[model samples]
Target: MAIPPHAQHDTHATTRRGGWPTRRISVTALLCALSFIMTFVEIPIFPPAPWLEYDPSGIVAFVAALAFGPGTGAIVVVLPWVLKTLFSFNVWGHLMAIVANLALILPAALVARRVRGTRGLVVGMVVGGLVSLVASILCNLVVTPLYTAVGIADVIAMIVPILLPFNLIKIILNCVVTGLVQRPLSQALSA
Candidate 1:
């Protein structure tokens, strides 16, 4: 018996403009909105750097990358930064955030794509977290001095004591949350 067109898989399925599958675009947009909303719910995990609060927006973006691929994940990461920057006008902070998040999401997504399975994801998270930690520190050295009263020296001083720990904690939190939810969310979204 032949499968109906609606029920059959189309290997040559038509994509929307920009080559994104329509479903991927829809999922990415929904995840972007969630990530944007999550930006408001920040938790101060590090006392010395309360200003460097943690938000789960990255988790959503990371999951989007894991599910849909890096491009969708990147859009999910940037949309929140754009929206937050519009409201706060903190261009430097938002730019740093984009760098940090993309650092995490891109590597994780790429590694996960290459490796496959839970092992792949675990390795991806570790690699992504370390990359994010390094990127945040480097961005802080350059960008923090531009916006805040802190000089480059001051930012460097804060790196080992404050920034390092804060970013480590933030990356771990995002990775853990993403790992926990990724499979379930992927299953649900695919369904």
Candidate 2:
């Protein structure tokens, strides 16, 4: 049988190239650059731990994952850290940032994938926040000692008084900012 005239062209041809969508690749790259730039704009929410600054870069990654997919979100999260590593000697800090971001974005993206609408995103953020909180604490216990004079006990001592609230605030801020922008940004991108 002969193919119909309308069916002769591959519908995906314009959207994809070399096993991936060209538009998606471009969009991911743009988001990565934005994320990297946002890293510079950090705010110290917790005075007790001024180093635990909050940056909106994670919002960019979370939105990317929510709009595109978890893989894209993961790339968006890590690329900024990789770029920072080139300029800064803080390898452990970069690694912890990557871990915390992936912990936040991955669960949300996965949950959003399984459940549709805002409800899914919200549920995922909550779960992601909890996961990130624990991950940050554990990471501090391991990585903080490597870079700072703080031992495991010192890190543990800081967790409740410093780390816990800091992570919670950061997670909430990222989630709220992402929630505000995600739908509008997704619509704009699709348009």
Candidate 3:
């Protein structure tokens, strides 16, 4: 690569996709670890729905997504939930969760990447939250009804009421925490 004679710094640069970058892995691992830790500390917000709960899994996913990209974020988001679903063996819930994670993380990461400070995190969180909110509504109003035709409707109904607010909190908290942590972590990891 030829350097610009007058360049103050190396403007032409590319990320090291080699060896998965130890630094990037550390950040991803930290967030992944945090995500696991949050699972046990679930805060149940019981009211509109008995199953309403606050889960920080999204935080880690969002952070990873921001640090890495939507692809990483999607996997990070899916892994734990997939683990949970596997253990529970609830196919319906697992499917919904997979869909939810896929919907939320990309928008959050995209927004997060656009800025470089607290504002970025806020934007990511907002975008993730809105995306999740809209997705939940669509799933609730459309997908679930169709899925219920077989034998899932009752279960879907039980989940719908909880879906909106649960996801709202999930995305917001995920975005905020990931946004906050990812910045410093990103700098540290990337450096």
Candidate 4:
């Protein structure tokens, strides 16, 4: 089926921003699959918080963003999440992961496209990452309490510390890895 004119126009506009072809799609898919695999390579930081395990999956999506852009990066983000919920239906964790990822990945993608150097990139992303982290936390803290009048205070206390650093790490790692990889990949992409 033919894409509608408006859709075609939008795609062409995005292409004008930065273009990619079939090989780029293949490269992005490879990275997305690698990200899903990396989810299994988790380190449990603690015990009772079974819902919380550290993973480096975000880095791969960041690579996709750097290689392509935000639209392509979003494609990979959903894939791993769907695969995870299929394997084990932890609805709460999966939902949280999805929300948290949307909260985190986008700004990082925008930043990834513009980042220049390792150290400078690190500082800039950390600042931007903090903005995302705080916004999400405040939204959660305010809204979560409204619904559950119980020890919402305790929930915030428990979650905020863990969440803040996790987000910070996610952005920093994504930015650093994207910065390191993008230049070399550009050579392949330009060809």
Say which candidate scores most in lDDT: 2
Off by more than 4 A, model 3: 1-19, 22-30, 142-163
lDDT of 4 at 120: 38
Q: List the candidate 4 regions with Cα displacement exceeding 4 Å.
A: 1-20, 45-51, 111-124, 135-151, 159-161, 186-191
TM-score of each: 0.90, 0.90, 0.68, 0.66
| Tens digits of lDDT, candidate 1, 108-136 | 99999999999999999999999999999
C-alpha lDDT of all candidate models, in order? 0.86, 0.87, 0.65, 0.62
Instruction: Please provide, for model 3 over 135-176, each residue's C-alpha lDDT reduced to its tens digit, 9 standing for 90 to 100.
Output: 766666555665456335564665646665666666666655
Clash totals for all candidate models: 0, 0, 0, 0
Predicted structure 2, TM vs. truth: 0.90
**Model 2 alpha-carbon miss at residue 68, Å:** 0.4
Which of candidates 2 and 3 is the stronger one according to TM-score?
2
Candidate with the larger TM-score of 3 and 4: 3
Which TM-score value belongs to model 4? 0.66
Tens digit per residue, CA lDDT, model 4, 1-191: 56555444334432443445445667677877887887677765545455457677766665565556677767667678778878877654555555555555566556655775564346545654676577656655655555456366776786746656655565566566666776687567545
**Sorted on lDDT, highest at the top, how do the candidates line up?**
2, 1, 3, 4
Task: Quote the lDDT for 21 in model 1.
Answer: 44
